[model samples]
Target chain A: MRTAFIKSLMSLAERDPRVWLLTGDLGYSVLEPFAARFPERYMNMGVAEQNMAGTAAGLALSGKKVFTYSIANFAVTRCLEQIRNDICYHNADVTIVATGGGLTYGTQGYTHHGIEDIGFTRLLPNISVVVPADGYEVDLAMGSISGRSGPSYLRLARGGEPVIHTKPIDQSLFGRALMIRPASDVAILSTGSILGEAVAAADRLTAEGIKTGVYSVPVIQPFDAETVAALARQCSLLVSVEEHVTQGGLGSAVAEVLSGLDNPHARLERAGVVHGISPNAGSHAYLRQLHKLDANSLVERIRKISNLSAKRSVKIK
Target chain B: MTAATQTSTSLARRIRSHALRMTHAAKASHIGSCFSMADILAVLYGGVLRFDPSRPDWPERDRFIQSKGHAAAILYAALAETGFFPADWLSTYSCDGSRLGGHVTGHGVPGIELSSGSLGHGLSVACGMSLALRADKKASRVFTLLSDGECDEGSIWEAALFAGHHRLDNLVAIIDYNKIQSFGSVANVLDLEPFADKWRAAKWSVVEIDGHNHDALHKNIGHMPLEAGKPSVIIAHTIKGKGVSFMEGQLAWHYKSANDEQLAQALTEING
Candidate 1:
């Protein structure tokens, strides 16, 4: 995903002479092309996130579309005030490309985890919060944000993430959720790199004679509330899956949308990292399994729910 | 009307008149700071900055951030004097729901480049603006006017180090060293003595001048690019209350606002 985003940024630089790329000294090899091609336009702001955000705002104020790249936590949290005052207040055309969107940096521990970024940024007005599911979606998001005005936060995974969008992603046709596979009995609302797990769960459910419709919501801030509600009404059961904390991640956003509307029949369940850190430190894959954010766990949980529902129907009869 | 005396006297008269009127209307303080920095603001808006009042967000306009933003009346006077907004807006300053609040805001005003009340943040924002212009290969400069007491902020030092590290020559910071903060004397509060040496030590080319002397102010600004590969700091020494005789050199004015009678007297003194 990092490779795709860099390539997309390079492409943007080629097209728009006004695009300036700034990094807080994080991208050494990944940003070489931008640094080499447009030395004047590319800057390594040297580990100062506040300065990077302010500089991005300044560039935007000067009529240039600016993008700042940094690791997830430093990129968003460190300079949040700058983002709020300089960029959001002015409504500057700046895109904060935040890499390492969740436990993608798992072994690196809690400091590197980007779980709360969406929650924090979602509260801000006039700033679009985007979480692209895969590399293809990252490319689509780049196109979606180009020639766009106002501020945006793009949460991205680090390099070597699986690709999910098998074909071209037309951003206009895309809502917060995309129905990857259709289902009538249950609906799965999934986000981020956890889409692979949700997909596997859906496949397992289909084998068990339960039709599942999976919706992928990439844009989390100005989420397609209309689509989420519509999908919620279509199924009796709605389950949200994310590789983020349950507090305000994709689950919370989806639940917020579902709570107010006319979805009385909808039984909602959310699957994500609950509160608290892991006791042991290991690779991200081990962490994913420990948190039950993997496919097998998701499938087992859904199967158990399905059995409970069957018993409840017999009790009603 | 030679540039030096004409700009000084005209701006001083406007500053005194407006400062008296704004504070009188709102019954607010910051009158002392306004009076002290009036000449400096005059020198900046009248002479140095490249801005178009007609187009507030003009792409090439030189950026100005008032780090000591509590003196919105000064910037308000400067902006109105420059025709950025109507001169009538001065009357509504600090009124209920007025855009011209006690501190500077970019919401309704055009010439206000950044919203500032937080002192140390402005220099950092200005430094970033300069870095951006350099990165974009634009020649426009950024000038931030700071109060002497604001130099005590750690964030200011962070920005100072950054400006020097980046060698941001296009960035020019001028300190309105009136030597009074919200508390008592900056000396009593926290001494920023040897302040010019502080900037010089931080790798900024330092220029010291009488902040009120239009000739000195203009001369120092005239020598832009003060040093290659270094940001420039003009430490303009000024008084707390410069033009108003009753308010001059008194720390109490920093907090106390004039009554109706004092307003009448100030108006009389300013016009006279």
Candidate 2:
């Protein structure tokens, strides 16, 4: 995902002379291509995230399409005020690229986790919060973000994650949810790099004679409410999945939309990290399992919900 | 005083008088802050800044950002007196639905580069603008005026270091060292005594001057880039609430909006 972001940014810089990149010194090996190709437009802004964000806004104010890069919270949380006042208020043409979203850096401890970034960024006005499911989505997101003239937050995980889409992704479908499977009994709506887990859980559920559908929602803000509502109508149970905390991430976003509907067809269930800091130190897989974010845990949770719903229907009859 | 100094001094008096009335009418604060930077704004808007009032968005015009945004009264007065908009707009300052708010904003107002009520944001933004102008090979320069109390913010130094390292010679920072802050004196709160040294050590060319002296302001600011390869910072020592005898050097004026009698007295002193 990180590799895809850099390649897309490099292509953007080559085409637009106004494209500039500023980093808080976190992109080590991945950003070399961009830095090497456009030395004049690239700047390593030292360990100061505040300065990098403010400078990005300043550059954007001067008619440059700027991107500020750093890892996780450093890119969004550290200089949040700058993003709020300097960038979003002015409607500057800047994209904030946050790498290592969620528990991708689990071994690095909770400090590196970007659990609350989506919540913090989505509240700001004039900013599009995009959490791509895979490398293909990242490319499509890059094209969409650069084509527009406003602020955007691109949350990416580490590279070498499984690519979910087999064929070419349509650029027009960048901000909309892409359905990987059709729904009959249950549907799983997933966001960010956790889409792979949702797909796996769906396959497992399907084999168990419980038909399930999966939809990958990459854009969390300006959410595809129509698709989500359509899915809710089709399925009896709608489950929202993400690698972030359940409070303000994708789960909460989907819930907010569903709660407003006149007659909600599906019972919404959210699968995400529990709210609070993790006490144990481990790898990505361990953390995911502990938080019930892994495919196995998701499969188990959905089966339980399905069984409970079936029993409730019998009671109603 | 030369003719130019007389003109700027007159402009400064108008800014102070307008600010006094605007604050009193709106029941707003920061009159002292407005007085401290009045002369600097006068000299800059008088002739030093390369801007045409008719063309506020001119590509080649020099950009000025007021980082000490609480002094919106005087900034709006300056813009109005310089014909960015009608001087009549001064009456609507800080009123409900007015474009002129308590803090400086550029939302609907002309001649404002960035909206700032938060300290430590202006210099970094100025550094960015300077870099962009340089990149485009445009000769336009960027200048930002900051308050001494506002320098306490860490983001200011972050930008200071960035500007020096990047050799953003197109940027100029002017500090209104008025000695007073929100709760107490700047010295009692946080001493920036070694302020000029800090800026110099960061590779910027430092200059110290009386902020109220229009001649000094014009002489120093009319010239570009104090050094060939360094950003410039001018530390202008000023008195809070300078023009009015009753209010000069009084810390209370920082948050005190003048009553009708006080406004009359201040207006008399400014006109005198």
Candidate 3:
């Protein structure tokens, strides 16, 4: 995913002279191509995230399309106020790029985890919150927001994420949920890098004679409210899953929309890292398994919810 | 062009008077902060900056970021009088539906480079602007006005170090060393003693001056690149609430707004 981002960004830079990249001493091997090609537009802003964010605002204020890159924790949490006051307050044209979204840097420890970034950046006004699912999605998101005005947070997974899209995705269609498999009875909506697992869950549920729909929602803020509402009306049961905290990420966004409806009928349940920060360190897959975010665990939870709702419906009849 | 057309003393007085009326009508605080930096704003707006009110967004215009944004009254006063907007807008300050927010806002408010109420962010943004100009080979400079109390922020020193390392000669930071901050005196709260030495050690060209001294400011600021290839910082020694006799050096004024009678007294004194 990171590789795809760099490739897309470099092409954007070549096309637009105003595109400037500032990294907080990260992206060592990945960002050299841009630096080599457009040295005037590239800035390694040292280890200061606050200064880097402010600098991105300054550059953007001066008619430059600025992108500040770093690990998710450093990029989002460290200089949050800079993002708030300098970028969002001014509504400067800047993109805050956070590589290693979620626990993509797991085993490196809890400090590197990006569990809370989506929730926080989503709360900031005048900023877009995007969590691209894979490399292809990365290209789609970059192409869309690289030129768009106003600040945005692009939460990227670490490189080598599965190629989710088969062909070039259009800009307008990127923010809305994409259906991996369309079925009517139960719809499984997932976000971030966990979309691949959602596709797998849909496949397994279909084999068991359970008709399910799978969707990948990359944009968290200004989330596809219309689609969420339509999906709620269409399905009997809705399950929202993610590789982030359940409170303010994909699940919370979906729940907020569903709850506000004029007495919607879809039964809603959420699956995420609900136990809070883990004391023990683990890899990405191990942590997903522990958090019940893996395909097998998600399938079990979906089946349980589907069966329980089925029993309730039979009782009603 | 050598000295500002509007005498600095007169501009300073107008700022204080406008602030007295604005704060009194709005019942807002930070009157001390506005008074402390009134003279500095006067000097900057008094022919020191390369900008036009008609073309506030001119690409070549010098950038100014007010880091200590609580003093929005004085900034609005300067912008209004200098033709950025109608002086009538001064009456609308801190009022709802007015472009002049209690804290500085950039949107719809002409002549403001960036909106800042957060203490430590303006310098870094100024540094970024300076860096961009240098990269683009533009002659425009970036200036940021900071409060002494704001130095307590680690982000300030981070920006200081960055400016030095980048050798952003096009950047200038003027610290309103008015002694007092919100909680207490700057010294009692957080000592920025040896402040000049700190900037010098960080590879900055430091100049200590009386913030109210118009001649010194015009001479020093007009003379750019204080030392070639290094950022310049002016530690302008000033008094909190400098203009009004009753308010000068008083910590209460930091959070106290002028009452009707007090406003009358302040405006009377400032008329001179």
Candidate 4:
């Protein structure tokens, strides 16, 4: 994910002179090309995130499209008020590229986990929150928002995550949902890097003759309300999946649409991290397993929710 | 520009008159802070601050961020006097649906750069603007005005350290040392004594002068980048209510809104 982001930002910088890159004394090895190519436009504002965000806002006011890159938690959380007042309030054209979304740096401890960024940033008006599903999606999102007006927060996974999209994803479908797999009985709404596990869960359900569809929602805020309403209408039972906590995340966003609907028959179940910190710290894979975000746990949870075994037992004529 | 110096004193007097008129009409307060910074705003709008009333969003225009945003009435007066907006708009201050609120807003006002009411946030924004200007190779300067009490905020130091570390030569910060805050005298509340020393220690080129001195303010604004390679901070010593005799050096005036009679008296005292 980091490699793809660097490649994309470098390409965008080459094309747009207004794009300036700023970091909070981080990005030592990854941001070399941006510095070398756009030396006049690049700045490392040192360890001050508040200043970095404010600086980005100032640059945006000067007709310069700005990008501030740092580890996710530090970039957004530390400068939360500045982002709220300076960028979102003014609708400045600055992209807050927050690397290490979710538990991408799991071993670094609970402080580094960027789990709640979506909850806070997505709530602000005029801010488009993009949670790319994979490297391909991340690359496309970069191209879409480079010179685009208004503020945006690009939540990225650190290191190289698997490239999930087979072909080049259409960059213009920014706020729309993608139907990865289709079904009528149950629709699974997934976001962020956890879509891979969601696909595996759908496969397990399919083997047992249980019909389920996977919906990858990359843009959490300003989600395709029409698509979500249509998906809810297709299924009696709706499930939302994400690596973030159940509070005010992808599940919460989906529930917002479902709760307001005239249809009272659709029941919603959410699969995500619950309250409480992870007991042990380890790599990203280990943390996912510990938190029951793996394929097996997702399958078991879905099985319990749908009661598919009993349905399978009643054989068709 | 000679009109700037010739009419600057009267312009400063007009700012005080407008502050009294606006605050009384709106039934709001902040006359003291407004009076204190009148001459500074006068010098800025009249002499320094390269701005055009016609093109408020001009890219190369010099930037001004008022950290002590409570003194917004004075800014509105100066901006209106310079034809940024109609002087009649000052009547709607603090009224419902009025853009001229008690605090400065960037929405309706021209020449105003950013929306700021939060103290200690302006310097950081100004530093950011200065950094961006350098990156663009534009010689535009950024001027930030802060109150004495606002320096108590930790974010101010964070911004000060950053400006020094980056060697932001295009940034200039002026501290409106009115010696009084909402509670009481700033010295009795939080001592910024050794304030000049502190800025000097932080690698800034420090200049201390009477904030109301028009010529001094004019001279310093021209001689900015005080040193060849440093950010500059001007410590402008001022009376809490410089022009008005009744409000001068009185902390109670910070919260006391003027009634009809008091407003008349304030106008009369400032006019002559």
| Candidate topping lDDT | 2
TM-score of each: 0.91, 0.98, 0.97, 0.94
RMSD, candidate 4, Å: 3.1
Candidate 2 backbone collisions, by pair: none
Better of 1 and 3 by TM-score: 3
What tens-digit string does per-residue lDDT give for candidate 4 at A38-129?
78888887888887888888888777888999988889999888898888988889889988888788898788888888888988879989
Residue B265 lDDT in candidate 2? 86
Clashes of each: 3, 0, 0, 0
- lDDT of candidate 4 at residue A200, scale 0 to 100: 87
Candidate with the larger lDDT of 1 and 3: 3
Error of 3 at A174 (Å): 2.2
TM-score of predicted model 2?
Answer: 0.98
The per-residue C-alpha lDDT of model 2 at residue B46 equals 86
True contacts kept of 4: 0.52
lDDT of 4 at B40: 86
lDDT of 3 by residue, B192-226 (tens): 99899999999999999998788888888878879
lDDT, each prediction: 0.83, 0.91, 0.88, 0.83
Q: What tens-digit string does per-residue lDDT give for candidate 1 at A1-317?
A: 87888899989889998888889889767889889998888878777887778778877877788889998889999888788888888888999998888888888888888888988788877888888888887877788788578899998987776777789877684445777888577888888777887888899888888777787878887888888887777777788888788888888988898778763556778888865857546577877787788888888877788788877731111
State how far residue A251 of model 2 sits from its true place (Å): 1.3
lDDT by residue (tens digit), candidate 2, A1-317? 99888988988898999999999998999889898999999999998898888889889999999999999899999899999999999999999999999999999988899999999999999999999989889988997987899999999999778899987699889779898988878889999998898999999999998899999999998889999888777778889999888889888988888787766478888888886657657789888899898999999998998888777741111
iRMS, candidate 1, in Å: value is 2.0
Comparison by DockQ, 1 against 2, better one: 2
Candidate 1's residue-wise lDDT over B1-272, tens digit each? 46665876687778778877888778888888888888888888887888999998787888899989888888898899889989999999999989998888988788998887767668877876887788667888899999988888766886787789889999999999988888888889999988888898889999889988888888887567799899999998899877778988788878677888888888777767
